[model samples]
Target chain A: GESVGLHLPTLSVQEGDNSIINCAYSNSASDYFIWYKQESGKGPQFIIDIRSNMDKRQGQRVTVLLNKTVKHLSLQIAATQPGDSAVYFCAENKATDKLIFGTGTRLQVFP
Target chain B: SQTIHQWPATLVQPVGSPLSLECTVEGTSNPNLYWYRQAAGRGLQLLFYSIGIDQISSEVPQNLSASRPQDRQFILSSKKLLLSDSGFYLCAWSPILWGLRINTEAFFGHGTRLTVV
Candidate 1:
């Protein structure tokens, strides 16, 4: 069975520091990947996405790196802020357009 | 320019009561709809997905069911709610690309918190 999972359950970071979240997926056929941020009592919000064709993609203050050989995915957040505190999840887009999500890593930013 | 809307930000129902959560998409047509549940400290569990009206796919076998009566309307229902069904329900939508049913990115609604007491 194919599954996506996170490397850490929780992460703590100081303000202005960089944060890295890791994810590993088992489905080699997956073509697209996305990162979502979910705040308390809210639905997961789309942050950024990268296709399998590209190794890396950059957004406003975020970046997503995909390693096809290792079947690994990572999200990097620059200048962590209090507002950035939330749970981050990595998802893989299957051929059917169904996204399989990881357990998620809670990102805590301390001021 | 598309948005998803889900109602009843919070809910509390008896264990045996019935449940119905509604989700609709605007600014798009013929989008793919999905239902997902998130338990405390867990990941998103996909429940059901629909590519078109009356066409649905169930990812998990449970007490829950979903329907797509209209192109942009999706509903999650259950005849008898269970304690295990209490969780955060999220509705998402994605545009279908031409010639293929694949979607680029999914957009989610605010979500509904259902607590079966």
Candidate 2:
């Protein structure tokens, strides 16, 4: 069975520091990957996505890096803020149009 | 612009009781709809998906089932519920862009929290 997983269950960072979250997926056939931010009592919000053809993609203040050979993916957040505290999930897009999600890493930003 | 709506924000049900959760999408036609369940401290698990009206594909085997009566309406139902079925349920939609290419970015609804007592 193919699955996606995170390297850490929780990550803490200083408000002004940079944050990095890591993920590993087992499905080699996946063609697309996405990162989502989920706040309490809310649905997962799409932050950024990268296609298999590309190794890295950048958004407003976030970036997604993918390593196909290692089956690894990572999300980087610059200048972490208190508002960035939430659960982050990485997902892989399967051929069936379904997404396989990782358990998620809770990002805690301290002042 | 597309939006997804899922309701009753919260629900409580007893064992062996029937359950029904509804999800609807607006402002998009012929979009792909999906149902996902997220347990505490876990990731979202894909339960079902529909590409068109009355066309559904189930990912995992369980006591639950899903249906798409209309292009924008999807329903998750169970004849009898189990305590393990209690979790946060979400509905999402992604538009099909450029022929059969499915959009990688999916929009999600608020979500429904189910507590089986």
DockQ of each: 0.75, 0.75
- Write one digit per residue (lDDT tens) for candidate 1, span A1-111: 688999999999999999999999999999999999999988888899998999999999899999999999999999999999999999998878688888999999999
Off by over 4 Å in 1: none
> TM-scores, in order shown?
0.97, 0.97
TM-score, cand. 1 vs. native: 0.97
lDDT of 1 by residue, B1-117 (tens): 778889989999999999999999999889989999999878999899888999999998899999998999999999999999999999999897785776487889999999999
- Candidate 2 chain A — worst ten consecutive residues by lDDT sum? A92-101
Candidate 2, A1-111: lDDT as tens digits: 899999999999999899999999999989899999999989999999999999999988899999999999999999999999999999988867777789999999999
- Candidate 1 is graded, for docking, as medium
Tens-digit per-residue lDDT, B1-117, candidate 2: 777999999999999999999999999889889999999878899999888999999999999999999999999999999999999999999888876855487889999999999
User: How many angstroms is residue B31 displaced in model 1 relative to the true structure, after the best TM-score fit?
Assistant: 0.4
Ten-residue region with minimum lDDT total, candidate 1 chain A? A93-102
